[model samples]
Target chain A: MEQTSGTQRLVLVVEDNPLTLDAVVAALDEEGYRVRRAVDGMDAIGEMQQEVPDLVIADIHMPRMSGGELVRRLREWNVPVILLSADTNWSRTAGVVFVPKPFDLDHLLDVAANLLDEG
Target chain B: MGIVELLGVRSAAIVPLNVAGNRRGVVIASSAQHDFFTEEDLRFLQAVARWVGALAHRAELVQQLTAEAAERGRRLAADELVTVLAHDLGNYLAPIKARIDLLRRRARREDRQRDLQDAEAASQALDRLRRLIADLLDVGRLDQGIFAISPQAVDLSGLARETAAAFQAGSNAVRIGGESPVPALADPDRLRQALENLLSNAVRHSPEGAPVHLDVGLEGNGDGRWAVLTVSDQGPGVPPDLLPRVFNRYVRGSGSSGLGLGLYLASRIAAAHGGSLTVDSPPGQGARFRLAVPSGDELSGFRGEAP
Candidate 1:
C-alpha cells in the first residue's frame, strides 16, 4: 500500500534464487511495494549504500555475501533487516526479524507491513 | 596367574580397552610370566589414556564438521532459488521490451494488426515469467517447510483434462490421448499445476503448430498396478548428456527460458501422490514425461472426483 507521503513502501530483497527472487518481487509489487533486489551479500551492501530502503528481506547462505554478514553489516547502519532462511536455526540470527523459509505469503507480507510502519 | 591359568581365563585383562571414550589395543598379563608386569606398565597406561582422549576429541570435531558441511550444502541449495530468479528473469524481460518498442514503431503507421500479435507474444512471455516466479517462491516455501500440501482425493484424469484445457486456451495445441475417462487419487490444484507445467513445456519446446500430446490410462505389470500420465512433445528431444539431469533443480539446458524448476516441481508433485515420475528423451526424437501412480490399496477417506 502507498505510504502517507504517497510513495510506495520500499523493500530491498536479497535473494539468490532467480525464480523465487522474482516471485517475491512480483508479489511485493502486487502488494503496492516498490522492491529492489540484491543477489549476494556483497551486492546487498553495495546497494544499501545507494538506497535507504524502508525494509530489507534477505535469504541466508548467498554466494559472495552471506545473509548473516548482510544483517551484521546493515545493523552497523541501524537498518532493519528481515532475515529469511531455511536453516533450522534461522531464528538465532541477531538484530533482525527472522522469518522461517517455506514462508506463508500472508505472514511475510504482514511482517513486512509492520516493519515498514514501525519505521 | 600361570601361563596355563591365563590361557584358560581367555585373557580377561587383555580385553579391548575403551580408553577415555576411545578404544585402544588391549594388554594381556600372566603372573607366571613375571615379564608381564614391569615398571613401565603404569606410565604406558597413562600415556595410552591421554592419546585416546585426544583422538576421540578429534573424531568428535570431525563429526561436527561433517554435520556442518551437510547443513551448509542444504542451505546453499535453498539459496540458489534467488540466484536463478535474479539472473534469468532479467534476461527474459529484456527481449520483451525490445519487442514492445518494435511494436510501438509499427503502431505509428496505424498498423494495429501486428500490434495485437506482439502484445500477445509479450503477454505469453510475461506468463512465463509469472510461472517461473511462482515455482521459485513455492520452492522457497517448501525449503522453509512453510508450504503444506493439503491432501484431497482429486480425480487425476479430470484434473489433467482441466489443466490441459487451461493451457490449451493459451495458444497451445494440446491433444488428450488414451482414455478420456481415466481417474486416480490426487491433489487437484497441485496436479493441475504439474500438468500445466508439462503442457507449457511441451508447447514451448515444439515447433509452432506442433501438437502436444497428453495421455492417461492404466498400466499393469506383474508387480503392481499403475496410473500413467504421459506428456510427449514432437520437438527436438533433450540431448543424451542432459537427460540424466533434467529433473535436477536449477539446471536448464540449451534454449531454456526458465529457471528450470518446472520438471523438478513436477517430480515433487508426483512423489507427494505416492507415485513416480520418469522421462525419456533421445536426441532428435521427442521428449516423453511419464507420471506413474500406484493403483494398489486405495487411499482411505479419499473419494475420487469423476471425470
Candidate 2:
C-alpha cells in the first residue's frame, strides 16, 4: 500500500538468514512495496536513519544490535516494527508482532501484507 | 605357550624385541585348565613382539581417525554458520560495491550497462541473504529441540507428489519416478521437510536443465521391512572419500550453498521415526539419498494411502 501520510512505503528488513530474507523481500516486492535489508540491528538502524522505511522486520539475535533495541529505536521514531524472531522470549515484548521460526510462508506474507496495508 | 594354554586362558601377552616400539607382540600360550604362563615362554614371545606391536599401532591409528572424523562433524555445525555469514555477506557486499562504483563513473555508455548489471546482481545477493537466514533459523530451532512434529499415518506417495509440486512451482524442474504403495507412520510435516531438503540438494547440484529423479517404494532388509524414499541427482556425484561424511552437519561439497544442516536434520527426522537416511554415490554416477522407515504389523496402524 502507498504511504498515506508521507513518501512511498519502504520496508527495512533486518535478518541474518539469507533464505528467509529473500522470501520476505520477494513477498514484499510481489506486494508492490520498496524493500531494503540489513544483516544486523546496527545496520538496520542506520538504514532507518537514512531511508525511514515505513515498516521494519527485524530478527531478534543480530550481531551488533538486538531486535529489541531496533524496535525501541523505531518506537521512539513512531515507525511500525514487526519482530520476526526464533527466540520465544520475544513474546514478552508488548505491542511488537512476533513470528516464530519455521513459520508458514503464506502466513508470513499475509501478516506482512496486512501490516503494511494498515500502515 | 601352546594352543592348549591359549584356549584355556583366553588371554594375550605383549613382548618387546628387535627395534624399540617396532617388534613388540605377545606369544600367547594358554591351556584349557587356565594355568599360569611360564618364564621359558617369554623368550619366544620377545622375538615376535615387533610384528604384533606394528599391528596394534595400525589399529590404534584407525581408532584415532574415527575419533577425529566424529569430532569434525560435531565442530562443523558452528563453523558452517560463521563461514556462511561471513563469506556470503562478502558476496552480497561485492555487488553493492560494484553498483556504487558504477554510479561514481557517471554517464558513460559502458558505465550505464555496469550500473544496470550491478543493480541486478545486488538484488540477487539480497535473495541469497534471505535463504541463508532461513537456514540459520532452522538450525537454531533444531538445536533447541523446538521444532514440533505432528505424527500421523501419511500416504507416502501422496506426500511425495505434493512436495514435488510445491517445489516445481518454483524455478527448478524435477523428475519423479517409481509410484508404488509406500505408507508408513511418520510426521507428515517432518517427512516433507526431509524430502524437500533432499530434493533441494539434488536440484542445486544438478545442471540447470537436468532432471532430478525421486523414487518411492517399500522394501525389506535382511532383518525387517521398510518404506524407502530416494532422491537422485544427475550432477557430479559426491567423492568416494566424502560419502560417509555427507550426512554430517557442517559438511558441504563443492558449489554447495547451504548451512549444511539440511541433511543432518533429515537424518534426525528419519531416526526419530525409527528409520535411517543413507547416501549412495559410488564415483562417476549420480548421488542418491535413501530415507528408510521400518515397517511391521506393529506399524500397520501408521500406514496410510499408497503411491
Candidate 3:
C-alpha cells in the first residue's frame, strides 16, 4: 500500500523510548515515507544538521534538549512538527500538531501526509 | 473598694462567682447607709450573681465547641487524605503493574517494540503516581505550616495557557484567552501545579465537550496590582451550602471523587505566594475559580521564603 509514487518524502521520528521510536519509524516507512530515526532531541538536531526532513515528529519529554526546544530551533527551517506527549498539560505551539500517546497509526499518518502535502 | 469607701459604704455583700462548678471570681454589691442591706436585697444580689455565673458558663461552652470543631475538621482532612491516596495509588499502580506483567510475558524480538511501549506507558503512569503522592504530602505539610515555596518572576498567562492546553484531549473542551506575558512573583512550579489542579478539577466536572475557560490578566489598581488567573467550567454548579467550605480540606461537593484535597492545596499554594484563591458558582450555572497573586511593584518586598 505505497502511497507515494515519486521520490518518497522524508520524515524524522524523535523519541527517547526505543520501542516507540522503532514503531513510529516502521509506521512511517510502511506509509511510503523515508523515515530517519533519532533517539532524543539532541540526536534529532544533529540529524537535522545533516539533512532536514520534510516533517519532524518528536516526543515532548526527552533527555538533553526537549521537543519544545527542538521545535523552537526548527522555526527557521519552516518544517512542520508533530509533538507526541503523555502529559496532558503539554503547551501548544503555533504551527505544531500535538498528538497524545496511544494515538492511531492511520490517524497519525494522515496528519503527517496532510502537513507534508501542505509544506 | 475605693468607690464604696468614697461613698461611705458601711457594709457590702460579696458572692463568689461560680462557673461550671468552679469559682472564677466574685461579685460585690454595697450601700452607703448602715444596715442598708435587707434580706430581700441579699436574695436579689444572689440572683444577679447566679445570672452572671450562667453567662460565664455559656461562654465556656462556646469556647469548648469551637475548639472541638477545629479538631474535628483536621481529623476529617487527615482521614480524607488517606482514603484518596489509597484510591489514586491503586488507580495508577494497577495499570502499571499489569503493563509490566504483559511486558514480562511478551519476550519475542518481534514484540520487543510493543513491550517497550508498554514499559514507557508504565513509566509515565509511575510519574503520575509520584506527583499524586507529592501533592498529598504538600497538603499535609501545608496544614502543619511547614511547606516551603521559593518565589521568582513567572509568566502567568503563559502558565495558564500551558496548563489549559495539557487537558485539551479526552472529552475536555478548554479555551485559554487572556493577556499574554503577564508577569508576577511566584514559585513557578507551585503556581503551575496549583493552576493544573484547578484545570484538572474543572475538566473533571465539566459535561462532556463542555468548554472550560481559563483567563489570565493583570488586575487591581496602582500599588495593588495582581496577576489573576480564572478557570471556569460549565459543569453542575457547586451546592450553595458547600461553596464556603469548598477550600476546606476533605470537603467535597456532590459528584466529586478523590480526597477533596485539590482545592485546599491550591489555596495553600496561593497563600504561600501572597495570593488568594476563591470560587463562585450560581446554582445551575457552573463554577468559576479565581487565583490572584500580587504583581509588579506590589511584589517588590515579596519573598515567599519556604518555611
Among these predictions, the greatest DockQ belongs to 2
**Model 3, runs deviating above 4 Å:** A1-119, B1-128, B297-307
lDDT tens digits, residue span B1-307, model 2: 8754655665445454433355443455444443345665666676556566666777878998999887677657655565445445443443343333333233233557766576556555654555566466556656744444555666677788889996685455777777445666678767987898889888888887788888888787797877788999888888887788888888888878776877888897898788899988867688989998764325554444342
Q: Model 3 chain B, poorest ten-residue lDDT window? A: B298-307
Q: How close is each model in CA RMSD to the real structure?
A: 12.3, 12.8, 15.7
Q: Give every prediction's interface RMSD.
A: 12.3, 12.4, 9.6
From the highest TM-score down, the ranking of the candidates is: 1, 3, 2
The residue-by-residue lDDT of candidate 1 on B1-307, one tens digit each, is 7767756543222334454565666544445443454557656665665666677778978999999898778767655655555335544453343344334434644668677576657655665655666687678756754444554555556667777876666555888878644446566667777877777778888887888899988788886767788999999988888888888888786768788888888888888778888988877778999987665226554433342
Best by TM-score: 1
Better of 1 and 2 by lDDT: 1
Which 10-residue span in candidate 2 chain B carries the lowest summed lDDT? B98-107
Residue B284, candidate 3: alpha-carbon lDDT: 87
- lDDT for every model? 0.70, 0.69, 0.75
User: Which sections of candidate 2 miss by over 4 Å?
Assistant: A1-119, B1-131, B137-150, B169-172, B295-307
DockQ of each: 0.04, 0.10, 0.03
Q: Distance (Å) between predicted and true CA of B247, model 3? A: 0.2
lDDT against true structure, model 2? 0.69
